[model samples]
Target: MVASQLGADGYDHTLGDFTAAAFTARAREEAGWLERLSTLEAATPDDAIDRDLVLSQLRGWVALASWPDWRRDPAVYLSAVFTSLFNPFQQRLKPEPELVAAAVSRLAEVPGVLAACRANLDPDLAAPLLVRRGLDQARTGRRFLTRTVPSMVRDPALSARLAEAAEPAARAFDELVAFLEGFACGGDWRMGERLYSTLLRERELLGYGAAELHEKGGAAWASLDERMREVARRAGGTADWRAVMESLMDDHPPTLEAMRAEYEAETRRVREFVRSRDLVTFPEGEKCLVLPSAEYTRPVAAVAHYLAPPPLTSSRTGVFFVPFTPDDFTEEEVRQRLRTNSRAQMPSIAAHETYPGHHWHLSHMAGNPRTVRKVFRTPYFSEGWALYVEKLLHEQGYFDTPATELAHLDCRVFRAARIVVDTALHCDDMSIEQAETFMATKASLTPGTARAEVSRYCAWPTQAPSYLTGALEIDRIRQAYQGSLKAFHDRIAGAGGLPLGLAERAVSRPGEGTPAG
Candidate 1:
């Protein structure tokens, strides 16, 4: 619930409540989770599996509970709130009556949530970038509520309510902008060592500090670079993997329609491969679709993206958002977008977003009887599990050609670079421009791609690194367990989406209810 209010993803919040009072109200509710965490941490459970699961989830709640304080700066809080507010309206979901009611209820609070934005935010503490992004999102959100939402509801009364709310929402955004202009933003966005360590312990249920993560991220970058050289040699190219990567971009599907078809086809192959190898169970009736990116979201989703179903909301299906390059884009922009999303890159991205990855992870997580388990997953578990599947597919001979195989490795390298830069950016170890330049040079990301990715890392701290940190952790657990690869994956799934520490305990122990299928 707190995650939803803060605009963090992965929580299936049924209620559409986002009023200013809701933040205070949710903070009060955190006392229970914090008390529970205290109790569980004090007494060791007789059942080892139960002990870890209880403590891990309780810790996640506590971390989420602290976000309001962590983001007291008006600009930061507004960005997340607006982003969260825009989610339901932006994506497609099942048109159930309850969901419709939820939407209506959320609409009622839009004005209040914005009002809270006015009262609680201290403008002077905000970062300039956050202020800028918040304004961009605010305009986008205003447009959404004013122009886009009325058509979706189809309720005369509700549509009227939305119309009434739009003005205050617009006014609130203007108020924020005016307030921010009064003072210079000097707030530190860095998590630093102490706070970063505390969050790592609470949110991810891990004990490692920023320094350890730095070391891990550094090693990953080195390992990936070494492998990229090997692939370059195999491709009969110079050691300049960047040149090879550039060459591959020219081989992309010629049109957006063709790109969509390619994704649809590749996703089919991914699912089939998962089933053929019995990598994981594929429940019937669950479907995955590939479609064009919505205009509002194109700036964020550079290539393709997958909207995983809400675990709590059963009506939704996974939809992959492929880039919809607008007609006004110069010919070069279209070419570059297609090139980055080339044939070699499609399979790995498909595997990461869909089968045995996000969609699959969410499906099983939604079924957990415990509400906390479903709602409180960390990005480490989610992203790590996805990247873990990439390596798993590679080991299983999933990629077709040497070119595609190299593409898989390049994806790994990109994630490793993310780990390195995310830590530096968050720790204030490097400036934003330095982070952008480093990624471009180290990982071969285009200058434009680096900027977009760095901007994203700024918005979401601790997430980009999760790809490498998470995948490496899952692989470590897999090696420890003496079982088949499918069995290892099944155990992790059966345990629900948990931090790797808890997942290892669940997977390693066989007799518990959360055993591998």
Candidate 2:
């Protein structure tokens, strides 16, 4: 019963137990068994499995668990934690070594938990243990993978094999632990070349070698720099780009009151603009709010981040987390940052983070009939759609002022530089020192800013490349559609929104015709 839910690929196991709980009580009761059974069922075609229903349940499960607060337990939150850790492109502002260590210890105990689950078999005893074990692995895996190498080393290929082999859960457990231990002991303190390369490949799924990715990133950096200079030249900026950026960062920034007022005003204006323009209908589940950034994230905190609403319930409000950097800058500097985070950009940001970006995408996926599609989100698809929204707004003339346009360009330059820095660091072709220099020189970032950015790239790896890679793919799809359809733009708007995979499939298929409303 459990095996049927996993589908043919068995990649569904990686999604963990949280998502499986949303279907029937039986699913929640035996999520692990269900997942295991699903894998077995996939390998055995004769098994009577309801793939579509299982997929729907999986989607609902993910939708319910997408919220950040879902993984409250250190043991349970392992997967997301490790996923974030291994992919340098997704590092948190502050690294939590202690939390990671605790998770790692828990992961070392997974075999016992699995044994307990197998012994019980009945839901009354088995379900709780299975769920706990899943959470434990997720939490521990996240910490171990991010903080050290043990998690990956213990069982690199076992996960795939386990998905293939039926029964012998004990063997699967042992293999996983062995792989993790070997991975941990294989190298020095710093993640060496092999681990870095493996991580990059695993995260990106791009099939490109590290060296190739580095070269591609370098090309993108050069292209973006030339474009930035051209934009500056047209704006009549006499100073060098760095000097110009420094000049923009004033000594005294706006007060928190002023900043809040500006954000609120912009939010209202943008909300009205999108509606007046007849952009896709904003879902009722969408909600927006403003909050100060936590103390830990202050140094690297951006002007704001949009917290997408939860999937289980319609909490329409999206959170806009703004860091209160009171002591960091003066009133003038604050005002400059606030101005950059302007009303004109609000609609664009909203479009990216809420309306047609994360919020809209997740909402639609959550509501979709296919559960697998909803639970299994690829960063390439998610981030790519958000980045595409930025370009979409620009094409529609959203940047009405010089300052607004500059801000938009600034963001583009930042993302382009991220691709270069991420690829360069992991490939070992460019040292941390060299990456920092390139960021400061080419991206017009300050030394402090460059250092933080480089650290993030080094820590997380293939994530940075997703912004440009995803956006470019989306752009190609849109162009292909426009070539065939007279009203391509209207068709997209009218169709509500297309599923990420469906869009990719349609674009990739040779004779699928063009995208339609």
Candidate 3:
């Protein structure tokens, strides 16, 4: 519906497939669907437990039409939207001529979508923190269209046509920039506690309020710090974590190529560990590999990202994109990225992004032939599972070395800090600069990367807390399961990629539906 109505250059990143007309008739269509859902619910109210999440997800789509969040710097939303190319976002699709043509149609529609944004968006709400970056994204989109997308087209005429379309798209970007000028202060995008609570209760069915999550975040941060000091004691004598952390940075692979090589080798090492430990069941014949972030994805995906197999599509393999191209980056920039790619960071990150982490979870989810499980995706369950796997691996001794151990603990600290930053930013207590400083100071992020992360948090107000929040919910379910570790993991896998609340419901009532908290 987002693809059909507002196009890909808008708020929600998950919904685009093929862009269509800017002004769509989907609003009334959604209303009809909502009416049907109401009728179905009234007739069989007992089905609420089973259909609760599906209904909520559908309602979210409906609510997205009127979402006030988009009013605040629609261009920033476009930044997220326009950042990835259409083909690779549809990377799993076979490159049949017709399919390519369809993708090209969508790619060519970038200008029309920007025009729609210019026509409809409220510039007063544009995020000050994001307008420059957002317009940068528009500028990049023109490059992508003229250079990237056209290069992919097989037919000469179509390629020429795509290149020709870039000019209007570039002009639309100017229009968007002009529209964005109305907001002298663009960072005013705040999801206050009231609406934040509403989204938690209704859209996510998450039980905790923002304040409570903030408290949990603070506690988690403190606990992880204590654990880090303990590990630091074991590693050396002192708990001066900065010294130890800096030492670990010096132990990484020299160049980005070497870094990628090490990561790929570590991928195998990680897969072996999961197999040897029997921590979780590894899927058969499913492939995952480390690759550079695509040109368009680099602006937003500064660290790493996992691209799941396209659902209900012919694509089965998943791509794990890590930002590690040293050529385009300077020596100092590369060194800072290497600090993130330190000996401590690599294997721990591998455990989270691959093996029993995102790649592992997604491969298993895709192999499952359940329609409902394949659909209705949520970030809480997905990120939570990855973060939980990080801790799970640590507890199982997957991270056995002192530096790896410290890195694992540090990852937790970062997740915990996100809860604080995400909550405080939305509640109006924390500014973006403050959040960046806090994250960089507490989580060991460089200033630049921290700023990028905080910008994303501003763009996506309530999303940052999901990593720890989802993990906490999963841990609760684990304690309640009374089963072996493998069994507990199997239960989570069976629940599929659902919200934690629904996943809990699934565990509580097995064979009912996929659930998340």
Candidate 4:
């Protein structure tokens, strides 16, 4: 289903099978691949790195197979349905007729796929938070199928066929939502200390455990807060960072339209900054577009989203999606959103999401000759690189003003707080409400945005920590590297999205003893 949504050839016309047998079969296939990978002899350093990457990915997959998310997470099936039906239209990789046919084929399978979801899930084991999330997505998906999908088709006959298929699909979504509403909701969402630590050690190959993560994150949060206060004194002749942050929000654009235009202009500014500074080489034939988040994606994607260039397709345009206020939002709701995306913060946002951040790093990764590296990526590298560049740009005098510097530091402080909140939620018994309050107070986020961020942390354990932890690790790597700044950036980008440990090995000097797979 993921491949289909990414426009990988031959996968567009089908949906994933979510039945128990399919799960077992997929595990078996992964084990077989692991065995084959173990027998290969890597002839070069790049091949060795790819071998290690694939092995680690397969091991993680095999380990996670024991959890049986298919039996507990309904969003797995619902998201597969939404992505499968929506991507063909959004990507438009094929001719219109072919795209419609593929969508209709996948639409025809939605009822069965959703039925399999019902058969597989254990109502007693459903987490209430996740169930609520699924309900929101299902409602959005139903709207997409019934109200949004038919308008995408051009031909009248194809449009009629799409509507016919959408009727049953939308009905299936409604049924799923109804079932979720009555869920037993007894399961715990936390990964717990043991499983969370295991993912950090085995999957991310980190050196520390959950306790150390919490400790380090707490220290960083304090350090960043103190730094922000100093910067605030410089900016406003006061030592109150909170007041400075609040004041910055009042300087935002009056409307969402002006905000979008600000983002567009900011992206252009950052692109030129990178080029003039000789930061890193841009990939050939690649461009990043600033756009509004799609309607179907807005339920979960509350702030910003980066859609990477499709791996298997020829298109090299990456999209950076900024959230747009809905038509029905009240004035206060609009103000809250604009405050979160204030003009003072636009440069940092542009640097983190587009030029020299996700778009630049991913475009380079997409050009990697090794398929394994492109397929198996870690946020440790992706998000870390983006965050690392923010700091890099700051050091290079990109954000020279006191206000901009405070905004950048506040963002850093937010990532630091994420590490603490993510660890506390999973290991230290922090309640959802407590985590949201912590995020809002420490990160200076609006209440609604704080809730959105915490909700994501619950569903995705360890991911929130990756932003800060990954950036710190990359900074460590840069300290030991012997090259110009641009050379260091290019070297890491050339290694693709390897785990930072493997990336360290990839960028090592001749006598530094690169490890075998």
Q: Taking the tens digit of each residue's C-alpha lDDT, what string does model 1 give over 245-279?
A: 77776788998889989988998999999999998
TM-score of each: 0.85, 0.57, 0.86, 0.94
Candidate 1: residue 20 Cα off by (Å): 6.4
lDDT score for candidate 2 against the true structure: 0.46
Stretches of candidate 1 off by over 4 Å are 1-25, 28-32, 41-54, 57-104, 150-184, 255-258, 301-303, 323-334, 511-516
In terms of lDDT, model 4 sits at 0.82
Give the Cα-based TM-score of candidate 3 against the true structure: 0.86
Error of 1 at 328 (Å): 7.8
Tell me the whole-model lDDT of each prediction, alpha carbons only.
0.68, 0.46, 0.69, 0.82
Give lDDT: candidate 3, residue 490. 65
Off by over 4 Å in 3: 1-50, 58-67, 75-84, 88-92, 150-187, 324-329, 512-517
Per-residue C-alpha lDDT of model 3 across residues 71-123, encoded as one tens digit per residue: 45555346433543443434524444554445455555656566555655555
lDDT of 3 at 158: 65
Among the numbered candidates, top lDDT falls to 4
Off by over 4 Å in 4: 35-41, 153-160, 325-329, 509-517
For candidate 4, write residues 1-517 as lDDT tens digits: 8776555689888896778899889999998998898889988777787788888778777767766678778788987887677657766677888888888888889989988887888766667887787777777767788667777788888888888878888898889888777767677788788878877776787887899999989999999988988999998889898788888889998888788888989999999999999998787887888887767766666687688877666677888888776555679987898898998888898899998999988777666666666678889788989999999999988997999999999889999999999999999889999999998999879988898899888888889998889899999999999988887888786677778888888888531122111
Number of the top-ranking candidate, with TM-score as the measure: 4
RMSD of 3: 4.6
